[model samples]
Target: MDAAWLNPEEWTCSEGVQEVLLESRKSSTRLTYLAKWTRFSRWASERGISPLRSSIEAVLDYLLHLRNQGLAYSSIRVHLAAISAFHLLIQGQMVFSHDMMVRFLKGLERLFPQDLLKDFLYKREKGELLIQKSKRLKNNLLKQMQLSVSKDGFVHFGDTVMLLSPENNKSPTENYPAACGNLTLAVNPDDITVHTSESLQVPCGLSAVKSVNPVGRNAFRILSVEGNSMGEPIRFGQNFGLGATGGFTDQMLYLASDHKSFMRFAKKSYLQQVFLTDELSYLTCWQATFLDPQLRLEYEGFPVPANTKVLITHCHTNRGLAVPRNYWIRSYFGKEYEVICHTYLDSHKAEEDKNYWIIVTANPSDDGITMFDRPKPPSEETREREKNELYAGT
Candidate 1:
């Protein structure tokens, strides 16, 4: 018969063939069959034959062509299975009988015996070795990201600035006076000198003594209070910064936390005017009617909220964290203060007279210890009062 006489549309129009095609459409198996049918049709057209009238000899020849193209044996098997299913639908029985299908499958198995055996063995293995190795590498990276603070007011681990309060561990007498005095600030791994102080000690922690030479310049500094006065877990000696700076930015990039928390400074009047509420965290943008009020800023996103308090801890780069590059603020709160910014850190040191800040240190290497946000625990009296109210049903 002239194979061209057997039209594909005619074959599809057959009662049982249409039903079989419809059933296949609802499954992945049907999709595979349709793809194989397309390839078979193309091959038939090249031979001037209708695919429907093509003999088993033609199918075998197509399979040989696939083998010569170096396709995986498993892929070839899927192609054969798809073609055989179509044959069964048209013939009303297994077109390649069960015995013939088995022989074809056996031939594929022989073609790539080692690969097939390896695939089988890999599936049987209790755990995926590659996955386990990947997990281990991730864990190691997390460990490397953890920030470490030392007792001597040195902050280490990632790019970080240590903001120390004299009150952290010292008596009132040990605290530095608010008045101007000689102070030391340090820079690290290179230990490059910036300033010299006659009164302050040299090689102090990770910082060196720097003399504030306010020559032909109006240098103004301000002290600020930080942390939740509502009695959160902020402890003494915790390192904090005023704004994002270079070194600290590098540290943050390495830490790679899912979220970041920082206190920002706002104009004093604005802070007083804005309504304070728990849900304020959800605000994307708001205008403050008040002026010059210091606002406490906690940034979960960036540009760190206009005029908010900023901690000088190293945050990993937003780029490394998959955040936008411009997220870090160069200047904020109408202040020209520099905030430490980086992907990693070594050691951090805090200057007690500078500002009070806190650090919430987390070990990224630790498993099953993700940071969580919850309401502060109620006081004992508050808890008892709540219990009493519940019992009274009022």
Candidate 2:
């Protein structure tokens, strides 16, 4: 707004000072740009937009307005140059020289190849194009948390109930593991305790993992199947059985394949009797392993922490357990998504992938060892007792 910066009186300062000042005021076209700056200022002031300190959105809106008024592309650049010079003189920042502004101009060039203004006016008048201002909002950046599970933690065999949590960007009340509006990984119980017999199905997909409506008690039990079965602590990289611990009938989850050549995408999961000495029982065994190198280095062979993301690998198929978020089906428990076992190894992106599952331990007790706890060394009496027990076994 100050024309004093444009025109100057005879300088009586030192020779070097006058020379530097003259160099700074070397723009001969400053007088021509004055009218452009005045027009922008008037337009901005009328629309409640500050000409001195305005956002990128405001600048974009002004450009759109210029295009709508049938201004030539060269004329628009001249106006921008004037605005840039005005901002540099007043605010000490060349706004149009920003990377975003440069990219925007390039994008406009590409989008409108020939007669940018004329084409824009034609399209806009014909109702084929419309420029809508985007509302300014905060970015919802997902945060990551790291934790470790120890041997004596709450992840016990056939006892501890847990929920598979997914990262949610929703509100705090209905977030991860609390699937109020979204699908939750659950098994449909054949026998309904609360509902009458007529309402229930006799032999539904048992232990079948489905992304069903969350019934609050949708949780699974982790059972150790490798060494010291059922009663011992479940460890990472060790074989285990996952059972739907929700309703009247608890079934062990396993991957079932139909001898199809396209088994990678076709292998569906089911719940059945895993402890029985049948050929299909081996499919029930699965292993939990870390997908991250840092996590594996620190927590490998250790008990997997509850509410932490880990890879669930099926022992029989040697494929990772996955829930295809796109595949939806109508189940006895309403609309549900399908779960399958497939090794995501064709691409190097498998190193950090969707195969990761969050296991959230339910009702964690105070006495149970947690991921934060450090293991204490055994005393002399404990060592003597262990030696005596070994000697007796021998």
Candidate 3:
């Protein structure tokens, strides 16, 4: 009966909570609260729970979800506080006012008794957190970070930045602990079949011969697909002087060629979560990897990139091209990422084996790949294909 209950502000993160966030914001509590609230909304939507009408029961379900996701205990308590605060802002009362909420959190404290106030950090399901401190703590942490970097080239800042769920979070190797970015994948080096038969075209109208082979049709798709961050525009199918065509540059072509040589490119796993701490220079290697953003590769039933696309043909053995290849697409962000496909979960590394992901922040490495300039005449095959295509269009 009260129109006040129908107000949109009752369910949104707006002015109502703005002052509260500022008033009680801690080292990074403001960001933590905002992020946790966002995660809450996302979790609610996925399960068909309405923000405006979600009940205490739903709050419990979310907590269970976070626990099932391996979030740290302290992180969970913070999230619990965030949820309670959010509800107070929107609903004008606490859905979690029940003593059980307090009791549950207290119980968790008994189990995971890590001191949140003293512990430098804790990781989360998605983003990372660097709790700023009273200049003293901040300087000490930075010194520690710098020391680690000097010793290890770069340190996987560990166990502090907390995410709501690993299923929903995917950061790169850098944000994790010392064990991330393990170069050796599950594939046996002996199983890596090398094919010395194909040629990879580069932008300079020249080609590089690759070693790995795929039995699948070498049907290539170089159409350059732009992503969130658009670098230099890679023209499709044009000889840009040693770059890839159709967005497929020499690096991509080389990887695809390797896939064909390996007999079944799918058998060998390429590098994932690569991070060279000392090198400021970077390059992204687009090994011929493909992903189905939804069906098999969905993260929490949502596509990881949510913009995954693929192109392939039904010709060739598909083996030469590698039927089910799983290589880390090192080109997306600077971090190497093995696309998580439902179909390949069994073959993927154990949770600890792979890097603790939070999305990539570093640029790609180019030690084994190349992208460039300098003109050369297009191959006769390219010229002929264009000629034939022009005539066919007419």
Candidate 4:
């Protein structure tokens, strides 16, 4: 062994190796080779050996170490190349014999399926080619589309057309052909409808709501309720303002467009179905009822089969303060009842009063029905403010 080659000072860092490589190859290729060299240098340094003068026996030892560490066969081959290159540069002789290289490559072929490796290589090469082609095409297209402005402040493209202003030059409906064989169009937000109700038909000016274009349309209405049951934050008379159109399906909940009624299929509550009974003929009209999967008629208190048609409704989770007796009477008598007029007087507020009116129709008759109502009020400060500002100003 030559003592000069074993000198630590003579050996270089992987970065230095890359600097030398840059003189002969492209920067990208040099960087890749440098990465491999760095790994080899680290491995040799850990073993107290000079990487540039490492012997064939040392190479075998490094390969065994890599295998013991669970490195893949392909990675080991890459390491072998780096080690061989380092030794050749320093010792002026080849470190790996042709037979050894062949054996190493054969081992890699066995460890990784040939089909998998071939596909990986094919995709890697194809990606590079595609990127290069895309760059060239983009440049050509940009050059062809470039326009020049004249003394009249009009943009001209080879005398085809004159652009008046920046806004006029850009067409709102221009369609660019895509590789997927579809024309991608530009849309104007002002030309489409974003929000509307089920009762009020979406205007024709907003008919392009379904179009898939930049600014084309997003015309679907959606309402998201945060409670487990339909009754909490949304009360009987509350209006759930529709913000968009066309997104609702059947059974989807909504406030009445007229803002007077809360409509939902009766029997939609699981609690009502679980408690239906025979003796209780008149179910609560405020609570909805429905037939369960077992073909059993169900209501708030009695899930029974008494050969009776029951009128079911929905209840808010807060539990109404007054189970209006009229609600039960209409359910048993099968007659419509007017919710003449009701008032919500918050005890917390002395001067403010809010009232609501409703008309309900119920069917089926039995007995033992209960109704309760509690009066709640807003703050006195709020009432005073409303009187001074809103009502007084009006």
Global lDDT of each candidate: 0.34, 0.52, 0.33, 0.32
What are the clash counts of all predictions, listed in order? 59, 2, 59, 30
- Stretches off by above 4 angstroms in model 4 are 1-22, 25-35, 45-48, 64-81, 89-99, 114-394
Better of 3 and 4 by TM-score: 4
Global CA lDDT computed for model 3 = 0.33
Cα lDDT tens digits for candidate 4, 86-142: 465434445555455567557656766754466557656765344444443233212
**Candidate 2's residue-wise lDDT over 1-394, tens digit each?**
2433332332456656655664564366767677788888999999998886777667768876897787767678888887876653233336677666788788778866676767677755754442311000000001111212324443667654434524334565534332323233554433231132311132223222333222322445565555566656667778777654233232333223322343223313331111211123565678888867556767767876655677877777666765544444554445555555655553544533435576654323454332213244699999999999999999
Encode model 3's per-residue lDDT on 135-163: one tens digit a residue.
22223212211000112221122201101
Model 3 lDDT at residue 262: 28
Model 1 worst lDDT run, 10 consecutive residues: 214-223
Quote the positional error of residue 177 for candidate 1 in Å.
Answer: 86
Model 1: per-residue lDDT, tens digit, 1-394?
Answer: 2122233554546666666545533467666677887897888799886666566667777877887787666667777766665553334434455555467668877766875766656744844444443343233222322223223331222322222211234444554322222221221111121121111122111211222221101111111123323212222123222211112222211111112234322222111111111111212111111111133232222221111122333222221101111122221112122212222211443222233222222223344121111134699999999999999996
Position 120, candidate 1: lDDT? 58
For each candidate, give its TM-score against the true structure: 0.26, 0.39, 0.25, 0.25
**C-alpha lDDT (0 to 100) for residue 87 of candidate 2:** 52
Output the TM-score of candidate 3.
0.25
